[model samples]
Target: MKTPEPNACLDRLYRETGLTLRQFAQDVNRLGTERGTPLKYREPSVYQWLQGHMPREAVRPLILEALARRLHRPVTSSEAGFPSSPDQLKQPASTVQGLIHLGREDMDPSRRAVLGTGLFSVALTIPGWPDVVGRMKAIKTDPQRRIGQSEVQAVSAMTDRLSDLDGEFGGRYARPMAAAFLVNTVAPYLKASASSETRKSMMSAASFLCYLTGWMAVDEGAHGRAQEYYVKGLELAGASGDRRAYCHILRGMSVQAANLGHGTPAVRLANAAAEVSPESSPRMRAFLAGQQAHSYALAGEPTNAWNSLREAERAVNQAEGQLGTFGGFSSATLAYCTAEVRHALGDAKGSVKSLKEHFPLRDSTDTQRSKLLFSSLLAERQLEIGHLEAACATWNTVLDDYPALHSGRVDEKVAKIRTLLSPYRANSIARQTAERSRELLVK
Candidate 1:
């Protein structure tokens, strides 16, 4: 029998799952590893899948397994468009069209869909997406009348609430809640009346809302949607003449590009951020440098990564000198950059150390959710390096204290741990942890 085209398979998968290519790849990888198949769900493989090339036999099973795990039910190849035999593969075009027809019936309107449910709940937990507070600080506030003050304050308060919800209820709750604020409250205000001062504030708030929305899309592994939101954020920031906001948007773009394996563009964008952020705070400069270092590391340019890391350190050291002008750098912020650099450099111990050093300094409020996330990321890195006990201990601590911190960035960490621990599932402790996490999901 003739082989099904890769694009046909890909189109079918999207139709069946409502997942973007990247999201599907991540899901495939996570589930594959967990099920002991270990398929490589790289970008090229996904592109090939979209073009109708059947994934390796191993990949086909992994895809089915992942869907079963995600949907909490048994799934068959026939349900996925591949039949049991070669002769079955010779099915008519209507067979394929019928699947597409059914997929459409299950499709949710993008705008009306809840932000953090299902796949997005898992997506929200990946490291490095900027948060609402960081985006807000990037925008310049008006010196005169505080026209956008109420809205800014509202967003700030809402961001805090969402962060708390993320820590307590998980990403699934936090995402939709945050998205609701953006679409229902913030986006409407962006289209409202304003004076020059109010306009700046409005732009700042809108840019932040857009950034948050983009972050949510990123968590769900929606790269295209994330890119669109980041571009819109950049435009909003530019309208306010906030170069810092522009820098933040560029950073978001860099992250998305790096994740998509477009490391060259990622590095270029990071460099542009570093070069143009003249008045950035020391912590902010360090943040940019660290991102550049990460991009370079991913590009396999070790020398460049090292140089950028050094630049990041220098920025941090000089932070004291510029304290009066730029405000003292937060230890948590500094640690976040340091941890990211170490993780990218393959220094798992260093990553854990940096995160531990910074974890204590994080705010007790939701603003410190990023720090908690870094700690979880460090744990995952440690697990990667074969430090299972240490990793387990770290996750246990996080789970004990912030059980609700299950979504946004924490879910990624959990998924990684789940994969790592899968090998030891027969071990009682590992089994307990896995079951605990699964149980938490239901809550």
Candidate 2:
């Protein structure tokens, strides 16, 4: 039998990473765990891969991602001595075309489970402003169709209505509808010819809807899918020269990373968002700074976190009575961000106080999903401080609204409530809350 030559490409990339064989294997194993498929590889496995032994197909992405993280750039399969995956082999040719493919897959009930299986990768490459800004190549337009500002306005109006539904119900029930809309209505519009002004307007509106859809995906606990949508949104935003939407999408990505407890990437993304748009309105500044504070706290940079928090507070104060900013940065939002920072920095009681401050500031504009999610967080912190009865009361409030919302995040919190109260099963309020949580979980 002929001996296969060593994988020179893999060896080259591995050498560039400068990691010990054991470290490389460990990194891959860690990434596998992050992907919910734990691995037990060691130095021998790494050596074998460098020696032309192919890793399992499913494991290749983990290896690529690990290398990408170490090398600080994208490491494609071909660069790592692996054949292109099916997805890559059939990759979409353009930004709009890719959006169509993603939306179509998301809209398909049969593909839903498969899409849910995509793993969130910390090493995923995000395009910078310079890389994507105003660089969308002209796409082939449908000669038979033409659109105008009315079509763009229609898309914007529909996005607003969808956002309301997502807030009132939950992403699980709303995301599919969004996907259907994107594929059925929006994608075709992108292919329809229009004046340059009208085209840019439509792209801007589509970018916002994409961000909303991605936000909904986050609520549904589909982080990988959310990232995909967010990237597309960023592309569209840049293509249309909409700096505000581009910054907004990047900030949204930061929020998603921070919520998933990925501190470093979260901080990187938040900084990118803030850095790209220095002349943004005070409210926009507050929104970006608040997220930066949370990311810094999660990354354990207490000084930076507090500084960012103060900046956010100052920005919010400066924006008082300013009405034109659309990102909705307010005192309530600042308080919530403060609570998150405090919690991340190990001040549980302070977090509880901040959360309390947040609740009263919230008005009719806040989503029901957020209201319940924050209430559940407050309950968890209350329980953490041994205030069992107080925790129970707060949890009851969440339960009152839980059944009506189909959010994966809210459901996760309710499940945790049951577990947190299990030790206090003898207490009546605790038992009742736990029981109700179990009932809801069953339903």
Candidate 3:
């Protein structure tokens, strides 16, 4: 049976509102808050609507209530584009494509688009999606041997491969593969009848895979998907009794919330992470503090950002004092966070400085791709500040080295640059760079 399309439901809701996109979102936000369920209506949320995506689960009900207020009538879940329960969601015959389609429908629109666009590039880098039937067979009949040293080594090798793919190809290209491996390989082993030590190792491996998947999803701009993965990772980490991995997942969730502009939630999540395990290593504490600082920066709380950043730095210092290494917190990760926080605070120059520091530490092969992405971000900031020539030059560098990363984000970034440079089309360099990017985009 064909499942209902979310767009059809959304179209009906919009008709009931009788308002344009902006008006509808405003009304929804206002009514939603008045009804005691606040909804965030940011630009990215608006972008989701334009792409024909509906919010999932409780969000749908909140939106419907807002619409009902606007229309002066009652609305139901059926009218708002959602299945009433898991049973309905399960009723449809599930082909792989069907599953993907339904998953897309349930996902936030921006996330769906990000995943759809990135799937091709990411799938090519990892093993193909598992055959569900084959996976079931393996789960049912696989050997019950305890996880040995070899299994730990294998898991480590896989994690390294995932990390490399994330750096070289972008997160969109790595997440699904990680997800597949988790569902097909790791989950089964975790559930197997094995020694406690083996089960712990399996859970740890699965937690790491889940964390990687979450990170990749975040990179692809799928905040909701990233959140789900992180939550699952947190649960697995708990089962493994791995405090360090739990801290990592918490940090990841905070980052996702911050990226989505939910700074308060991000701060709360980060604080909770830090509080839960007081005796976590200095490096782990620093990582958590860095994430909290990022959340504060997004919240426009500069004092908090500065304080947390200082705390993170102090923690790093103490770790260095104890053992010449900063626990497991790598310099690259620290530099990336510094750049991110600066960018969020609208300090393009500071962001650029952090990026410069980070660039030297990135792998040689990743240099071009990383620079292209950073330059694109810097170019946007420059354009915001009315530096047209600098913006144009930055975008030119991005387009010139675009293929290095195979990133959908690069395409989106280039598009933004083109839009910014449109007014300066008569200028030779701007026109040439814009046209070249347009041509590459077309191909």
lDDT of each: 0.60, 0.88, 0.62
How far off is residue 61 in model 1, in Å? 24
Report the CA-based lDDT of candidate 1 relative to the real structure.
0.60
Worst 10 residues of 2 by lDDT: 320-329
Residue 120: error of model 2 in Å? 1.4
Candidate 3 residues lying further than 4 Å off, grouped into runs, are: 1-146, 277-282, 317-339, 346-349, 353-357, 361-370
- Point out the higher-scoring one by lDDT: 1 or 3: 3
What's the ranking of the predictions by TM-score, best on top? 2, 3, 1
Model 1 ranges off by over 4 Å: 1-171, 175-178, 184-188, 191-193, 256-262, 278-280, 320-329, 365-368, 406-408
Q: Residue-wise lDDT of candidate 3 within 1-443, one digit each (tens)?
A: 55434466667767766777777777667645533356768656744754556576545655665565455455666665554756445664322222234334323435555333221110011111121112211233237545554665677578768877876787756666666666555555554556567656666666677777767766765554565566566656666666666766766677666765657667767786777653766777677888888889887898898798887777766664222211244455567678778888878777766766775665444434456767787777767667778778777777777765656556678777667788888999888878888888877
Model 3 error, position 321 (Å): 11
- lDDT tens digits, residues 1-443, model 2? 77778999999999999999999999999877766578999999999999998999999998998887777577899999999999788856688878888888888656776655356767777878777777655688999999999999899999999999998999988888999999999989988999999888888999999999999888877788888899999988888888888999989999988998888889999999998874667888898999999999999999999999999999899896633323658899999999999999999999999999999998777889999999999999999888999999999999988889989899889999878998998999899999999998898
Q: Give per-model TM-scores.
A: 0.60, 0.89, 0.67
Which tens-of-lDDT digit does each residue in 58-141 have in candidate 1? 567566655554553455666665545453467633211322222232233354243212221111211122332223323333
Q: Candidate 2 regions off by >4 Å?
A: 1-53, 66-86, 89-92, 321-326
Model 3 TM-score is 0.67
